[model samples]
Target: MPGSTDERRAAGYRPLLFSIAYGMTGSVGDAEDLVQDAFLGLTRARQEGTEIVDPKAYLTTAVTRLGINYLRSARVRRETYVGNWLPEPVVLPTDRPGPAEHAELADSLSMAFLVLLEALSPVERAVFMLREVFGYGYAEVARATGKTEANCRQIFARARQRVAAGGQMIAFRSSPPERRAEGEQLARRFFAAAAGGDMNALLGMLAPNVALHVDTGGKAQAFGKPLAGRLPVVRLLLGVFRRAGILGVCLRPAWVNGRPGAVKFDADGSVTGVIELDITDGMVQAIHSVANPDKLAHIRLNPNEA
Candidate 1:
């Protein structure tokens, strides 16, 4: 019974651990690896007759430490990235499927918030995600990161302040049906405008200060820097549409990290890239496009669903 109980507990906490890892690293692949490594550590401990007083706490700490280390090393690669480094987009299930389906949790999982998390140091990111996003206490966060409670409190305070300074605060909650429908409509219009190369229509829908972040990872063709201002962004989009017209690729709306976005597909129906827009005040504020082939392996585009 005790063994079964331990197994159940491990299984129950896995999603939570995965959320924490993904929150810190912003890569589903990295998060999965970190979570698996943590569980493997737990199994090794059990085999060596080590008793874990609180398996959840132990596992959380393991995952956090692993995430911190991974981030530290991954920073070098990110620095060398070809262009703007956007977080890997992950699909969120529509229906409430598990304990991870809380509205606040949904908010934190957005690509925007994950991009902000990049501003924090590895330890600070872990502390902020554990304490603020996941609702862990100072004591728990401290244990997870091997920091004193006072140090963790300071780290979280600093991290929160840095995130707040990143323009506007994102409301981390699931959109109601009506609001979601509105956003979907806006996304559809924007997609159509881009597809038709209607620069004026796209300009009307874009906020004056709209910026575009594109990640090509040196594997695809993209701008070397983030494109800012409406004119520049519109010109870039028009050029892209013209090129897509020649190449026989088309844009179809899809959900990118729970937000309405478009995916690019070649004539053979293989995905070329995914684009996500951040909307505010009925206008597009920011656009994030990820064209890195390695980062898109987790997403399977349904050719028929559009």
Candidate 2:
């Protein structure tokens, strides 16, 4: 019975540790691997009778250290990566996430939010996550992250300033019923035009300063960098779709990360990518094309709707 309870405690560490590494790395795959590694380390400690009175804190520290190391070595790590990059967006059960879980999931994992976090150093990121998301005090964050209270406070202040500059909200709950329906119709029209290779039709709906981001992860060719301006993005998308000549790529409108999104599906029904749209004033402001197959595992689509 004691052993079973210990195992359950060890298992519970995953969500907490994943929240840590995923908050820093923003890559679900890497976050899961980090949690697994942290648990393995814990397992070893338990075997050796090191005794974990607070497994969550212990694993959070371990995962944060791993993320710190990853950030320190990110340039080298990206050298051999598959392609152009972005973090894998996490999707949590929002309707029932409640206040605690919603706050936990929201502050810990949104793509736009995490991008702001990327601006911080690994230790700073750890400090920010602990202090802001986990509700830890400066003293506790300092202890957890192995920093002095003063340094942790400074880091937290800096992070707060940067995050404020980003002008992002704490939560982006999916559009309400009526608004969502309207948005879905708009998404459907735009997606159909793009998928059908209608450059003019697609461009008509885009804002003059629309931006597009393609994440091929180096596996497939994509825009080497972010493409800005509506004309340029329209041209780029037109060129790619025209060149590929693949037919029947359908996008089903869905809510991912509490925003308007669509999943790309091939004729044979496999998910090829997820395209998340950010809109302002009825025009597409930003387009996030998530093409890393490894990352889209959490997204689901219905063929009947497609």
Candidate 3:
């Protein structure tokens, strides 16, 4: 439960609200902005002498609706996006694991899950996230979205189907410590192969039909379209790393979106890019690369880490 004062309550609930907003919008910047806006709305409402019987419910509704509206307006920009769009990666520290405040929803934070969410409509996404990811009951979901319980149920069903069709829904459960450790180990080998230019090892680790999706926002260097098939992806990766090596770039393994991934750093310790691996059954299914400086702006790294 949150504190009695509006400001204290907002502070206490920020993590929960941030998880919801990030899940809904798939953009860290947008999520933070939406949370701020929601709190501002709460303050204004209180100033107007409005009674807030349940601060949690009121804030949840405010953030969810703001996310819905934000997504509705962002669709146009997304449609016109120059290259494959990827959710801004949520990079976490690998050495010091933090408290699991919203760990139950971690799977939904993955790049794969967030990408599938793009297939859904604004309200549909809201209803589905509230019910599925957060475990909110139909009644609670309806209250948040201003819809009837029946409507919320129907929306959730439809959204679930759509997401499933787009791709498999990541289980809502948090990854066990051993599972996460295994993923980090695999990621280390994958990046080592790439950096060392060991094509054979890389090929062995990659799924046969693995695809490479890069988001450069047409503002940086990247393949204009996604590259499919193992050989091509491996070739491209080797070539990129070969070039990167010459430029004195290094890889620092980290937990990306709650999965194993790495951050790329330049000679001066600046973040140049991020790589998130979608591993399934001991094979890399997809390689998601984010090089657009705008997207990497939020990523912080210690240069000596690598």
Candidate 4:
């Protein structure tokens, strides 16, 4: 067995470290890589005879700074991205734990919430996630962010204010399995109407102000901007269905970010794109379609499950 310190550092804290990094970067692969790097850095510090008073604090600080640096580099790339960019979707288990167990984690894991975080600066985003989602105190957040406690508080306040003002605070709670089933049903009905070009049926399921945002990364065909209102979105989707030619294209419903979503598959069964719906009061409020090949690289669509 490994030593006690190794067990504590590697096993006890790895998940929390990953959560922090993911909240910052919104990329599962990048978060895992950053956590691994943090662990390796800790090993190097120990080997070099660096006196560590608190391993948890040291690791948190290292990971936060690393994530901040990574986000700064990533933002430059996003600036040139085609269409309305979205965070890479993360599929969650259908049988999720109760809200009492992982309520905050579930709250922050939604694609909409992650997209909201994109509006913040790197340091501001880090401060907000640490304080709001993880419930870290100002002192701890300050230590992790390498800022004064006052500065950290100011940053968090500013971030909260900006996010609230942006009106992107729609919270996706951890619902019971039956609620998920309802969402899946809604998605099925909507897509069926879309596939059949039933304008009346599709309009009945959409919110009056339903918004559609598609990201193709300039690699595929998509609108240059987001489409607003129900009728236009319905028409655009119908146009898309007509344009796809239907020879080998398939659409399947799956659970995306803990909500019902659909995937586009080629005849050979590879995933080509993903569509996540924000359903509110049994109506689709927003449609997020990501066809960016680079973003879809990590998504695996299971046709047999939702």
Best by lDDT: 3
Cα displacement (Å) at residue 18, model 3: 0.6
In model 2, the worst 10-residue window by lDDT is 93-102
TM-score of each model, paired residue for residue: 0.89, 0.74, 0.93, 0.87
The lDDT values for all models are 0.81, 0.69, 0.85, 0.79
lDDT tens digits, residues 76-119, model 3?
99999998999998887677643343342345578878888999
> In model 4, what are the clashing residue pairs, if there are any?
none
RMSD (CA, Å), candidate 1 to true, equals: 2.9
In candidate 1, stretches whose alpha carbon ends up further than 4 angstroms from where it belongs are: 92-106
Report the number of backbone clashes for model 2.
5
Report the CA-based lDDT of candidate 4 relative to the real structure. 0.79
lDDT of 1 by residue, 1-306 (tens): 248878987878877888788888888788888889998999899888888889899999999999999999999888887777887776433333323422223445667778888888999999989987788999999999999999999998999999999857665556777777777789899988888888889999999999898887888877787899999999999888888889999777766666768778888888788888787668888899988988878766645445
Candidates 1 and 2 compared: the better one by lDDT is: 1
Task: Give per-residue CA lDDT, model 4, range 1-306, as digits (tens).
Answer: 236866565556776787788788877678878988998888888778886778788889989999999999998787887778887766544444332212224435667778888889999999998998888999999999989999998999999998888876776557776777788899989888888889999999999999898888889877798899988998898988765546567787766665678788777777788888988789998898888888778755454443
Residue pairs that clash (backbone atoms under 3 angstroms), model 1? none
